[model samples]
Target chain A: MPDKFRGNLLALAVMVCLYERPMHPYEIVLTLRQRHKEESVRLNYGSLYAVIASLLKRGLVAVVGVERQGRLPERTVYCLTDSGKEEVHQWMADLISTPTREYPSLAVALTFLPVLSPDEALRLLKERALSLETRLVQGQASLQWVQRHGLPRLLWIEAEFLLRLTEAELQYVRELIGEIEAGTLEGTDFWKALHESQELSLGIILSEKAQYPEETGIRAGGQGTAPRKRTRHG
Target chain B: MPDKFRGNLLALAVMVCLYERPMHPYEIVLTLRQRHKEESVRLNYGSLYAVIASLLKRGLVAVVGVERQGRLPERTVYCLTDSGKEEVHQWMADLISTPTREYPSLAVALTFLPVLSPDEALRLLKERALSLETRLVQGQASLQWVQRHGLPRLLWIEAEFLLRLTEAELQYVRELIGEIEAGTLEGTDFWKALHESQELSLGIILSEKAQYPEETGIRAGGQGTAPRKRTRHG
Candidate 1:
């Protein structure tokens, strides 16, 4: 099997590869594809150029050298900057770090619970469904492209994997609408959560305890300090 | 339990809140704490500023309206732009369509088979461990600060949850090193597959492969192609 980087991780992978030897962009692409393992990392010039520019801007990488073949286009090669090297070093040190976040949309959606009406939340859910549908269309298109392009076996994995996740959300949303319609779930934490999400402010979030006095009070509906003491740790 | 935004979805939470009301940085912070349930979203200035700025730059959000809020201490209220509203709409729609990726650093790290020499790979792993350690340390510090400041219900779930994840990764990395040394685990594909990582460029990888074609042939390790028409699609 081969190594892979996903999304932003591509930057780090590029850093890792550059650490070994300076590489031209075309060389970089060809090298990645030849490994057969890096199909996802395999990028067109637009994406690659964008990343390279971003890396230079971030001071994580630089143009170490460039080369031109007799009749071929001039090639610009890139390498890790000291900062880039340090970043890679730091990232390696953090390899054992835990998987912290859940998902982008879900994480963000929960925050604005307070301000939005229940109807609005439902509306948002529906909109997300539409986005997923778009993605599905895109995924299917890519799948066809890959098969037709004579791409190797793994090309479909990402598209398929992403689709599976999308499908799960689609089903969950349908189930959610059902819960809403049936009135089996209502007038509860869901509403409050939305409120709290709406309420997020720097002062309030950092001074969480001070602001959330309502939650701690007997009336706020949660059991008190028992859970609190434990998180106070070394 | 509140109908927690499924997976602590932060982006949706923030976007929705902003759509309903444009809050100055500090106000947004205050709300998240006050509104937290057993589990809730956490947003700090750095991240908050970044997202808001990005949104504003992209025209997804506008300073459509602002509040004076007494300028001895300056503050600008943020309201979503019309486009921002559309974006939030689309964001929700997308969420409904996709599956969320979990924390998979170790898995992602493993994707770059043979890209890094054993030493370089080990170095990369160490960096990851360190980065996790730093975040854990920062999160704990924040947790303590919030606890002392008297937050509501001390909504500690997020910091604690993140801490545990980081701890898990540290342990996973140690085990990974052992597996590598034992030679019981070899092949880039295994790491790539497990991690759902992106692939490396074939140029550098192919050169390495060509060095030892006997070990890798037409099927060529984990490149995007199906191995022997293996029918991997689900």
Candidate 2:
């Protein structure tokens, strides 16, 4: 409920593995890799031990046993304490059931895209379309590989999600390129005019800076006074 | 081209705005908000200035003019340097055209799911399904709002992407729940067995630690064993 343990994927992973069975640190590493979980959860042995030590400090796990197998180093196994079990369960519940904000870079780029010249924007978008198409093909092949290996669909749902997302993005980008080519994009005129006017305005400002050097003291750009005029809010 | 300036959304937004024309810091803030670009890019005035100062330092943007408007603080206008224009265009090109690795938290969550009990996992998946459905409805309403406001589909493609993703996730979770209920999931049996055996093994480990404290000196687990077992590669 405190949500303090959020986003610590390594801790989540260690707890998850310990919940399955008490494991020595070495066994935990071996098991995670054997199951291909290393792809999702980082599997640094040093970090794994640190997490275990923290878990012990928190009383989330306790030393269960030690094994001396044919001169191998003493392997101290760990198992989840009652609190550890509860922690992992609640953490997973929070992660799965909640829809938190994710800031995708592509989303951000698209939001500010009107800055580019339409022709340039179109050419770039076509490039994007081609890239997305290539990715879709790669994703499809990867999905096929997963399927061929006979991994559970549930286990590889992430791949499926990604493939579907790539497909959707490819379709959307293609449609957008078509709209730009047909001159049907809603903001095209505004975007183009914004670029043209800004270029001219820059010329004026550059000359002004040259004429009055004292007025243009560079303190910082973002610290500006609020406009006295009420600007429309989104 | 080295993809150095990729994913800095604030810098991208600032550069994009300056690309249109020279703008004082306050004007940039106002225009970003007015255009609803704030929804995607963070609009913190302090960070905006920091980005601007960095841009100036890097010679990406230059001071064009200074304005003293009606008792307001002296406002320094900024315009993209020739290099700034090229940087923004190339950054956008990389962002749109390259499919960079995005590590979504949900993908990570799915990877370690075997730790949860089947019933508990099913319950959580159902909860997620419900949340996704709620989000889908809200996303639909937001899309309708954007459509009614007459914003271009191109501008609001992110909303569309989000909606589509939500729908896809809902469908996947529901299907996953069905697989769990029907006992048709590929790894459910293995997961259940792992949990049962691990719980039993922990009982033994706890008792062993009690009986033989000497063997388990436990100077924090994992400071044990050979320095050289070649760990398999991921």
Candidate 3:
């Protein structure tokens, strides 16, 4: 299998559609939309054509037949070759079996979290918790609707997994917020003190300048020479 | 406040480094690496310089001084402007509080799970469960090591969140595998029957061809014309 087909969900979806029966590009689009596979796989006409052309070149799909409907353009139908079928199975297996490294935005955010003031951090986190709660409720309702329509859970299992992930994040975020609010989070004092000292230092600088006007002028003049020295070096 | 900086983790990391104090690019890189931030943020010297340049152009970082050590080239030291500090806080808050949509590969795979045989899916999922378990153990050990070093949890909270997500996914995959094995998955019967019927049809077709060679020849001859007819249309 080519590397392009290995991790390409859109290509995998196209192949899976062909697995059931030969289909033209239009039929494949309709089937994917009807199955709501578009939610997981990015679908666009240009990319679909590009994928089909690539798959054809790779011998994963064969041009089975062409059809015409009155004055319409000829539509080339395609079917998965044996190699394509094998690729689909192997690709799906690899995706399900492997845990690849992914960088979630939230994880990146939390890693540099000390950038925000503690109070502001708490406020933002609370907002996130609320958003997650709303999403959980919406996800639950959507899943229940699908169940009510007699759709099998297997078909919508991705949604279930996503909901579970969201629930876990919400739980973790809530606990973190609690720890911060209770002043028990590790390094909370240091994080808080860092900001406090910044403010204190700023205040001290202002007060000292106000109290010693002539001395401040001499110091400012002396500091001004540093930039001139840098200019000379440049 | 530029959209470019909104979700730019590298830019955020750079700004946060300057928030500490004025530092040249080299010092910023050294600081980020010393704090083990490269694990969460993608860092490359070229992109780091590009991010710094963008931040400088946006007036978020000001060149505070220039430094030269021995024969080394002069390095411009940068510090965050007041606006830069505000942007950092707002960006961090937005990232922490916002629950954006992300497409995980596993979720995409599960959406198309029916593409594989139930047996294969179960086997692959079991492998995933094992991998997740091993990762969980490794992650725990690493976190313990950091804790033993007396590093605050706040510094490594992203790892904690990642571990929690991994645990959630592992639990879900295991349950799915169990349901499939026990024949309790909602569509297990349908899924199994689909593959079985495909195999049965192939067997029947082969047996029919052997038993009625004359009729099979006619069908093959008819199918042979399909390509010719398509060629005419082309």
> Number of the top candidate by TM-score?
3
Error of 1 at B162 (Å): 8.3
Residue-wise C-alpha lDDT for candidate 3, range B127-223, written one tens digit per residue:
8888888888877877777677666777778878888888899899989988999998887787787677655232211111121111111110111
Better of 1 and 2 by TM-score: 2
Q: Candidate 2 at A201: error in angstroms?
A: 8.2
Query: What TM-score would you give candidate 2 relative to the actual structure?
Result: 0.69
Clash count per candidate: 112, 4, 0
Sorted into a CAPRI-style docking class, model 3 comes out as: acceptable
lDDT of 1 by residue, A1-234 (tens): 012322465566677667667887666655555443353343456777787777888777888767776877777889877778667655544442333343234433433322344566667666656655666565566556545544432223333433444455555555555555554443334444544564434233233334333423222112222323112201
For all candidates in order, the CA lDDT equals 0.49, 0.65, 0.72
lDDT of 3 by residue, A1-234 (tens): 755556456788888788777889987886665454555676779898988998899999999998998989889999999999888788888888887766678888888777677888899999999988888886787677667766677777887888898899999999999999998888788778866765523221111112111111111011121111101122
Task: Score every model by TM-score.
Answer: 0.48, 0.69, 0.74
Q: What are the runs in model 3 whose C-alpha is more than 4 Å off?
A: A2-8, A21-30, A42-81, A199-234, B2-8, B21-33, B43-83, B199-234
Which of the CAPRI classes, incorrect, acceptable, medium or high, describes model 2?
incorrect
- On the 0 to 100 scale, the lDDT of residue A89 in model 1 is 52
**Winning candidate number (DockQ):** 3
Task: List each candidate's DockQ score.
Answer: 0.12, 0.22, 0.25
lDDT digits (tens) for residues A59-115 of candidate 2:
889999888877967889898888988887788777877755556677777775665
Model 1, position A194, has a per-residue lDDT of 43
- Candidate order by TM-score, highest to lowest? 3, 2, 1
Q: What is candidate 3's DockQ?
A: 0.25
